[model samples]
Target: MTRGPGRWAVLSAFTVLAVVMLLPFVIVALNAVKSPAEYSSGGPLSLPHGLYLDGIVQFWQRVNFGQKLLNSLMISAAVAVLATLLSVLNAYALGIGRVRGRLWILVLFLLANTLPQEALVYPLYYIAKQVGLYDSRLAVVIIFTVIQAAFGTYLLSAVLGDFPKAIMEAAAIDGASRWRILWRVVVPISRPTLTVLMIFFFIWTWNEFFLPLVFLISNDTQTVPVALGVLQGDKMMDATMSSASSLLGIIPAVAFFLIFQRTLTRGVTVGAVK
Candidate 1:
């Protein structure tokens, strides 16, 4: 009986917290549908007279948001795929292979992750310029892939390190090559971790601003975040249009999360249990 009441109390507290956190999003969504005049004159918290698409349409045209969105999607997808693949291979080698100095290598990866992007950005810019990748989408993709791979390697290595070794021995006895065992056995079993890594990579790369802003100098090459910054800076777009653009910018990430919510939840729970 006491446990029941305690559980209810905790749930009630969490419910209130959720509502509080969601209040900003609720406010944004409401204001996004409002007309510019309404947004300027009426209170931000007030409801719109009616649902309107004018703000969204005007924002789309004013900022050339469609091209920016496409750029972000491409860069994010490429980074996620490349980073996840590299992480899986590196983790397998370091964790499951029991490589010499494996601990040292992981420590190096941890150190790499700890290094702030700001510290490396200038050096990276010089390198990209020399390599002829400066101001290119490929430049951002490559940079993020490497950066995200460090963290991904750390996570997947931890999970893979604890994986059952007996399975590896059994597969070896069946005359399986290392690559065969890794691809056929290990990867299949590590889908949850991979899924989690992919989701994180996608979200991080999609939301990235600094690198893209620095590297993507051309207007057409800029990603959504960079474009949004430009849109906010433009005097022509008032509050309503800015709000609409922001709403549009977040839709893809939110939709992606909702679509993969089950996989994400499973991955997190599995990681927790392990």
Candidate 2:
């Protein structure tokens, strides 16, 4: 990790890894605009003969892509926010408050996080059906909020456990209640970590497939991943159109990551010049 001859090896490794990750995107982008005839003849690795818009346009319209975008954005944003808040609250109680048997409580959250979604599918489906939330985005939102929050609590609790007791004592002496101190002091100090958590939660929820597939069977409630699956399975789809679908599916998540990427770097570099 330190600067040395080893750094060159690390850089070379990352360069190769980056190329591998980016290769699919490049292929998809090129093929998204390739005519079916060209794609059939030359395949995905080939350069496009011309700019073909029809397949991309048709795929977009066929999938009702705008709705899928909205659903994915809404669900991911909701889960990210709700999960972060829940994690903060749980962490605050366990770490800062030091509630009795807090070790067991943290363990409980860790186990909840480690538990596979497969194990909960049937119960979630049944409960949602019983409560009339099945096939609803709200149900998915609720499920992921709890699921993501469990890990967040596990992580943030440890971070807060190392928080400066001196600062907390100073705040208390200045007449700050625990509630006020949490929002005004604790949350502010923890913003970078919380932001990182939010970014991961948003992206993770955005890319979720299986649970979304199982629960969001209705076209009206489906997210981008679900829509991509639907697009792939459609009998009328062509190779070029499938590529266009993949390209479309990738753009939003990539855009989100790139935009927040600045925030991530900023968080890490904030104190470097100080």
Candidate 3:
């Protein structure tokens, strides 16, 4: 089909929006590799005179960046796996099986999703402290898993709703139990949507700052963002080195999104249609 003027206009507008959103990162990146003198004298939009590794080296050493990176990856991966499994099970039961008071159950999940983060923070802190989970990696992992699970359930349910009933009925006729149908049928057909959710949850948990800050007090257990925040809060962080560290912090997240860009688009669009 020939492209229309309206479609072209919309595309141009979207391109502009994307650039605007990306502008900060672009500026930070330029500043990261620039010397302190250049960072201060040169405009953020200016091109760098040369690449410098000092900022990155100093940032890495001071923050123990390698350890923080692993901490973030472990927490995020655990959350994604646990959240996906629990959400898929909940969604399958709700979407495919007959149950009593399903509407109320869904209403409760929606309510849980809407609860304010600020309101829950103190109570969550208390609970974690009581359980001796404060300042631990598992604490943040558990919190991320639970918080993301509500929205995950909602998104998975939407995807499952679009599934045809005939396939499930045939599976039941063949003596397939609910567990078999869920594992052998529902999951296989829902790969795209699952990929989308997994990526979304991973990114969200990986980038999470407040929960990590509240739960992780020890330097050893800190995730990337919390560790970066510590670095950024230091009096010396106003230098170009701080900007470099900030750039480093954003690199993994950007790479993850790029890798999953296709699945994310499909998953989001599919969920939206229902």
What TM-score does candidate 1 reach? Answer: 0.96
Per-residue lDDT for 49-136 in model 1, tens only? 9998899998888768889989999999999999999999999999888899999999999999999889999999999999999999
Residue pairs clashing in model 1 are: none
Candidate 2 wrongly placed segments (more than 4 Å)? 1-9, 268-274
Best-fitting candidate, scored by TM-score:
1
Which rank order by TM-score, best down to worst? 1, 2, 3
Highest lDDT, which number?
Answer: 2
How many clashes would you count in candidate 2?
0
Query: Which one wins by TM-score: 2 or 3?
Result: 2
C-alpha lDDT values of all predictions: 0.91, 0.92, 0.85
Better of 2 and 3 by lDDT: 2
Q: Per-residue CA lDDT of candidate 3, range 157-212, in tens? A: 76687689999999999999989999999998787788888888999899888878
Instruction: Supply the TM-score for candidate 2.
Output: 0.94
